[model samples]
Target: MSKKSRPGSRSRALVAATAVVVTLLTGAVGAGAAPATTAQRARPTVILVHGALTDASVWRHEVEALQRKGYAVLAPAMPLRGLASDSAYLAAFLKTVSGPIVLAGHSYAGAVITRAAEGDPRVRALVYVTAFQPDTGETAGELNARFPGSRLGPDTTVVLEHPGGSELYLRQQDFRDVYAGDLSPSTAALMAATQRPVETAALGEPLQGRPAWRDTPSWALVATKDNSLPVATQRFMTARAHSRTTEVASSHAAPVSHPAEVTGLLLDAIRGTAY
Candidate 1:
């Protein structure tokens, strides 16, 4: 009886060992394949394109906020040259991104994304942050004039002739009033001092090809107190593009003055498009 029991115990031990080996192999395969499956389902990258008169630093807060939620974020410096040239540059940059994208633009960059995202399938959605949404064959300057509330006239800006072309800058004295009325005076002064100027011709250059907003789903953040591009103009453009609109009591520099609200709007666009 003891010998028979011993044989049965050995058989059970062998079976248990085989089962453990199979389980380990299965887990190894699962561990290796899980990341690829998860990667395929990962959230889309968020590219925040800063508008003219400001560099990518304008998206600093949004970048930080988005990163906290595990989203990959990039804020590229725009050439701010001409519409065609800048759009070409942005389109080229989009090529470097590897997965689905939630493309966002602030102020003048909206016009750039409008054209740059054309024909690119990776850009899942467009988020306009108090941005310019020009139509095909339309120019930023033209859109600025569609409404009467804008204060971004010659009075609030300065023009300088560079070797290549003239660049436009927000005047430090009036930057707070025109672009960042919702911000503190000190912060506005710092922003004015560091603001990057856009080429004068960029504002007047017509967006060459079809506007991406015409094809892609879009979201717009309207800064109700914005003085640069008037809220009315923002509403008109977003409405024409059929964009989901969110209004906040912010200035033209919504990204800087209201980063959390801007982040929320961007997240909305991401969730809406990142199926």
Candidate 2:
């Protein structure tokens, strides 16, 4: 009987070579394929604007905290002149940022941001910290006058015909008691000495457009023990603006005295706007 036909050594070698070539060809195709490009992550920029009688320094703690958490934070020095001019200035500044923004305002800045953010689709959220949330045709002064508990009237000093309009300052003697009751006396003194004055006209300027909060999501921090802007007044304004609100037992300088709480509120705003 003829020997059973079997694969010859040459045929076996050819089969092995083909398998190696196939494996190498498969690997080469995979290696040459383009890697999936990860979509660039988007993060909203946070802009913190200070109110009357204070500069951007007030947001130091908040800035530090937010930065540590990987947020892009900016505390712009707002020209605390008349509302129209300041809002225009801020609006111009806003135009320079490339992405969505979470705008935060303290005291008079709330009104400024309200005006600045109007008609701007990039502002995703508004945060009012012991701030004035004025409606159209309403002034910060009007909002402050709506309630009677504020102790700021007597503590303020006015200078007419100053450079940027009628300037207003907090009396150094009353700064601690009226604006920063929860802060250390030394720190409060330094704050009083370095506080930036606001033009009186800014407080009286009536808002020209519907507040951004009317259409944007909003968060408000009510300083319960505030002596500058009455807590009740803060509540009323926030309620009118339909803001998500939280109250802390703090003075008007809540951002300075209870920074953690203030920072917490701001982070909440950031999270609310994130997809």
Candidate 3:
């Protein structure tokens, strides 16, 4: 070589080259990561909370439908122990999720979310699918009796007592007429046999805090033929909440019997809450 390079100069040259490569790679990664993050923030997560006498399985159709549409959905199992405790549990669960949420509750799950979503800014909207939307100091039992035609009563439910508290299940014989009138008898029978029992105290437990529907935008599905919660009661509750409402001639088990309708209403809520 005409001029031999110094070791120091050679080392510096190598480091400079490495820095340039790293900068280029970092810039490429940053560019790719930005869009992914934006997409995640753009869509709100849909959290479906099932009510008493059922579990997350009730949202099977909805979960699949929404997933096919590229939406993130979760149907968490409600404790169904009592209003205060169940709401507390849901509120805790909500804290673990990131970004925004569109919370939907069915039947008694409505009251759960009504209290669970309180003061949570992440909950952008509330969807009540033939569910209770009890205000502060209101109980589910009280709301059920606010209107006539609810077939759910002592006659239709079987009570079981335990050390903790009593639980109630829809009698297998009356389950079809009371809960899943729109579903086939076979399907209703399976539901009846597999239905979960709810703590009887949950019905009388009042919603302790401010209902989320009071502040959040709300959508409701009024099952006109609902035997567990009458159509008139659904209308009254949704009206009080000033909810954007849809009416379907389904039973209390709208998600099971009218899955498409339930999915459509949930999509409306998702689109509505999207930023």
How far is 196's C-alpha from truth in model 3 (Å)?
0.7
Q: What digit string (tens of lDDT, one per residue) describes model 2 on residues 1-275?
A: 87765679779889999999999999887776633211123678999999888899999999999999999999999888799999999999999997789999999999999999998998989999999888889998888888887777843664657554578888989898889999999999999999898888788889997779899999999999988899889988888888999999999888899999999998898888852
In candidate 2, which residue pairs clash? Answer: none
lDDT of each: 0.91, 0.88, 0.93
TM-score of each: 0.87, 0.84, 0.86
Candidate 3 residue-wise lDDT, 96-150, digit = tens: 8988999999999999999999999999999999999998899999999988999
Cα-based lDDT at residue 3, candidate 2: 75
How close to the true structure is residue 67 of candidate 1, measured as C-alpha lDDT?
94
Model 2 clashing-pair count: 0
Per-candidate clash tally: 0, 0, 0
In model 1, the Cα lDDT at residue 165 comes to: 80
Q: How accurate is candidate 2 locally (lDDT)?
A: 0.88
